[model samples]
Target chain A: MARVATGDAFTSTQRAEIDRAIRDAETVSRLEFSVYVGRSDGETRPFAQRLHAALAAPARSVLIVVDPPARIVEVVTGGEARRVLDDEEVKLAILAMQSAFAAGDLAGGVVRGVQQLAEHARKPQLRHTD
Target chain B: MAPFHALLILFLLPAGLFLVITLLVYLPSMRHSEGYQPGQVWRGEPEWFGGPRKGVEAIDETEPAAVGSGRDGGESGRGGASGHW
Candidate 1:
């Protein structure tokens, strides 16, 4: 079997759920979404930002970095991504995730964060635009 | 050969065997005996480090250029925030 992620971080079932949530979030926001669950080698924020920059399209991607042992959660938005997912919206997602992690619900926290970000970033359908 | 040499060798043989057995079996089990251990933090190396990846790619420290890494193929600015639980 392909061990895509660290086994202990999430079981196969849980990983599938989280992956689905990420895909759904991407669809809603029309942005790239990536999630990383591992220990942070350095400062969590900088490490997350580094990870964000390395993505294929940094400007339109949303990167979520979770350092479980450190109990840290960071939501990074690319340039274009930030326009739709504003700072406050990102903070709200972080807050939600933090609570979930505090309660030892890693998968739940990620799913909730992804949903919240996607919700905040979703473009409202214009009923009438001449 | 000294008279006490045989006795010393006999004592050392058992002692060495016991040490080898302890190292081979006992220590590792005790070190990781806990029910579950969460994954370690990112340290530039993981089991799948050099292997081909799909979807999300881990950060490469030396290479700043976004070659085939990102999904969107756009430049990213540092615009996100962080929080601790």
Candidate 2:
């Protein structure tokens, strides 16, 4: 039997689920998605933006940062990504995640939030474009 | 019936049943307890999933560049939302 690492924030199974959610979101959105689960260095928003800025392709990426202890969640979107995912849409996803977090479902909240963002940001099908 | 056989069935049956019931009651809770709860401070290092190659270490050293320098100017182009539980 594989020994569970008690020090980890998420178990192996939860990690797998989060990974799957990211993968699916990328496939749907054609945008990179990153999730950070831990403490914020300072103000949560700036920490999240810094993390987003560090992405290889920040202009096409979305970063979700969740600080459980601080009860803060921030979603930072890049230029191209922001075109598709407005603040209103991102706020809706945050609300979904916040409710889940309040219930102590950290992994589930992340997964759901990622999926929701991707769903909202999915490129509208280019139908009948000459 | 043999004395050992009777004792084995009578004693082991209830013991096994009790063990099964206990496991059934506790298994879900054990799974749920794995992750951090609200307002719980995390002792583990921060984790970034599907992040840049340098991972969490890069963020501290690298200042946020002019991200989203598109039609929208400065940070205004970089849109997102913040929340708390």
Candidate 3:
């Protein structure tokens, strides 16, 4: 994992992984994934809405926000992303990332979060569907 | 040697044991969820520093040096104007 900078600025490598994570999410669910890193006013609901608008992904899109200095991670999903990803699923992803973050594993958190998103977005096979 | 030495040894033992448990037992399960590798590049343009305008335009102008130069100047000018908003 890369060192955490004083601010939310990601290392070049970290930024690349984040972008890939979003892109992978888009590919799997055909939904836009936007990540915002900044401080929120100790509130998550409004921040989630703003992220949802900025990405302009379908209501089913996913938004991940990290207030690094504050050690906060907020994962929000639109209606569509919700069909496949429930609150519990999103929480699990957050929990995974949270553990990594607490362990000083920023890269690990991002990779795990993205992986969780991809897994949650996975379409059931026809056999499974039936 | 001294009482302090014995106390130091007692403290160190538990600390070492905790570290061992954390590294040997807990770390593997945590490591398993780390799915993607860091530094993996994506298909889209890289995000530039500053705001989306700076990041997006810088990425858009990466090709063709001459065009990129002109676009960079134009973008900077536009960026200056937008800052006033």
lDDT score of residue A39 within candidate 1: 72
Q: What are the per-residue Cα lDDT tens digits for candidate 3 across A79-112?
A: 5676677667777788888887777666667667
Cα deviation of A128, candidate 2, in Å: 4.0
Q: lDDT rank, highest first?
A: 2, 1, 3
Better of 1 and 2 by TM-score: 2
**Best-performing candidate as measured by DockQ:** 2
lDDT of 2 at B75: 56
Q: Chain A vs. true chain A, TM-score per candidate?
A: 0.91, 0.93, 0.81
**Candidates 2 and 3: which is better by TM-score?**
2
Q: Can you write out model 1's per-residue Cα lDDT over A26-130, one digit (the tens) per residue?
A: 888898888887677688776676776666777788888887667788887887898888889999999999888877677788889988999999998879857
Error of 2 at A88 (Å): 0.3
Better of 1 and 2 by lDDT: 2
Worst-scoring 10-residue span by lDDT in model 3 chain B: B76-85
**What do the candidate models score in CA lDDT, each in turn?**
0.70, 0.84, 0.54
TM for chain B in all models? 0.34, 0.41, 0.33
Candidate 3 chain A TM is 0.81
Per-candidate clash tally: 13, 0, 3
